[model samples]
Target: MPRFFSNKRLIILLVGVIILVALIGFSLRDRERVTLPEQLIKDAAGVGQEVFSKPAGFVSGMIGQADLLLDSYAENKRLKARLADYAAIRSEVAALRTENEELRKVIGKQESLRAYNPIQATVIGRNPDQWEDRLILDKGANAGIAENMAVMTADGLIGKVTLVTPLTATVELLTSAGTDYRVSALVQSGSGEIHGLIEGYDAERGELLLKRIPSEFDIQPGQQVISSGLGGIFPKGLVIGEITEVTTDEFALTKMAYVKPAAEFPMLDHVMIADRIAPEIEPVELRPESGEAAE
Candidate 1:
């Protein structure tokens, strides 16, 4: 035991190194049974790898999706523009169809009024306050349109011209709730059987009521009623509507019947004006000096 050759501190340090080498060799030999310290190191390394791998995978997925979105942007814009064009085309087609229908109606109306001169008129204005009761037309006195002239649709009569201006005329519907006008009409049943005056309208039922008829006559239903042309205001043979029901009036002295209008009022866009049913006869001027007047 020499002091310099045999140092206790150096001996202890050498033994510690030998023991550390032996432990590492033993751990390698029995690698399946890893020691706690090595197991802890493996787990920490695995956790670090997983943390780094997850972030890398997430970033990669985000970049791929972003590229796809950027590529689709132009295509989406193109699709949107195509949709707008398709919508515009649909609107144009619808407008064309509507115009064709209106034209057809006008033509049919003119044909129906072949006996009388027909003036094609367009509905210009309809006030909501009197939408169903009245309609403003484009034709006026200049077009030979006069007050009390019958206004008709393609199917049948709708109203009568009540007001006329230089360029426009106003029509008062036969179905007007406040209508004071009356039409002389008769039932056309092969024989001139029933005749009555169209006096008022039933607002609830949207029908014209005929009054002042002989209650003794049996006026049956489904009979075709038309203008009698007796008063000379309304023309003859104009189809009004069929007799739906016949009953006694409130006074029980006269007969009353409901007549549905043939015209679809409040939805009309075009109509025909009966310019004149008969030719206007100029009055013959008489002079006082004439032979007939002096004689």
Candidate 2:
């Protein structure tokens, strides 16, 4: 080979240009085989990615676990509060049950004293001559009020419906001086209940006379008296009054107790008339049934 220049560097440069052209041609040619250097470089990059991804996945998993723990803590607090509230409600229910049981003992076997339907009425008139005996209400038969239905104030029983019209009804107070006026009453003595009749009123003392009590029974002052429900007119458990004095009849056959009325009859503005579920039935005459002759 002839030296192209008298320099060793020029000879090296001509050979380098030939090798560069050969490498460019080899790279551009269509080939499926990968070069060894390229394979090594790609494998190193893949290894680095795998090494870094493991730590990233571990960190992400730890973060997710921490979030779940925080959420569980919050939910536990809420559930504990609800449990406390449930305990409080249960205690209240137990107290109410105890109170109701005590009330049942005091009221006796009467399942409910308030079983009657109440009709609200306003006092529209009071007869001056019969101020302590009779008053008129604004509701009557058309309003489902009937004769002998018990009338009461917020405090206690006071009267009964004696007459009913379309738009008005007359109520006879317990303080009436009528000779025939009577009420079946029960005196709640320490011994037991003493059945009696409320036969008369003492206008002089402003008290009621609960008579016909058996002399054997011991009744004292300050004992309570209520309607006995033996009379078909009044419902059971109507509070009448408290006893103030006790005495025997003229014949000494029975006892009598003076009762201080619970209701203030003169201050009556609003009243409730009790319409009992059970009504008194009148006997019907069994006459000729459709042309049958009477005996």
Candidate 3:
């Protein structure tokens, strides 16, 4: 130590060590507040730490938010692509149906009530008050829509056009409470066709009523029900529903069958309007001869 440092230098080093030890002992005392110099040094250090840490925290937060945004964008893009594919598929199916009808005509097949042109349409509006009773379509008179035209979904028949306007048409569903609304329906069984009238809906059971059926018809559950083409509105072979339960009428004279509808009435979206090419028979009106039958 003597060779490395002169006497004066050694003395200065000893003095510096003594001062550092004294400062440490002073800071160790349990005081209420720090000294002015110590407080100043601590404040500067805190400010420096906050300045550096705040920017780092902000940058990290921005990166995390950016990652979330990127993920959401990717998901939305994927969904839009899938929706486009679905729309294309619907268009292709409609085209194929049209082509099939043309091919049938080319083969000179017998014209049947089941043969009709389909007009594609979309459900636009529904009245909350009337809910299952009625709905409105986007197509109207300009689209060749007429009243009494059968409206159906991909699943099966839903209703018929009751009113038409220039740009919109209203449909009265099979579930309507009006007693005047009736559909000529028939059940297809192994033996033959059993005719009945779709008169009302059983709200409690969520099924349609096929009434005025002969008790001897031997109808049972699981038999398919379809339009009979006698109603003059709906074409034949339009799938209405399937039989679920069979019961006797009030007088036990005729049988009534509860039918589960093929089309989902509560969730209608897209539909087709059937335009009948072959003429249907109209109801005949009786005329009094020479006012002899005024009564």
TM-score of each: 0.54, 0.58, 0.59
| Ranking of models by TM-score | 3, 2, 1
| Collision pairs in model 2 | none
lDDT of 2: 0.78
For residues 1-295, write the lDDT of model 2, one tens digit per residue. 9865767787798889999999999986533344667545544544454456457656766887898897998889899989989999999999997898789898864444436888998765567687458877767667999777899998889988876655567788888886355778999877788899888789999999998899999999999999987776677788999999999987899998999999997667679998876555332222454365422
| Candidate order (lDDT) | 3, 2, 1
Worst 10 residues of 1 by lDDT: 279-288
RMSD of 2: 43.3
Residue pairs whose backbone atoms clash in candidate 1: none
* Tens digits of per-residue lDDT for model 3, 1-295: 4398889999999999999999889875534344566545544544454456456656766887798887998889898989979998999999998987899899987667877999998665566688448876766777999877888998898888876665567788888876346788999999999999998899899999999999998998999999998887678999999999999998899999999999998767678999987686652222354355422
Model 2: lDDT of residue 224: 96
Cα displacement (Å) at residue 43, model 3: 75
Give the alpha-carbon lDDT of every model.
Answer: 0.72, 0.78, 0.80
Candidate 3 has what TM-score? 0.59
lDDT of 3: 0.80
Q: In candidate 2, which residue ranges exceed 4 Å CA deviation? A: 1-114, 279-295
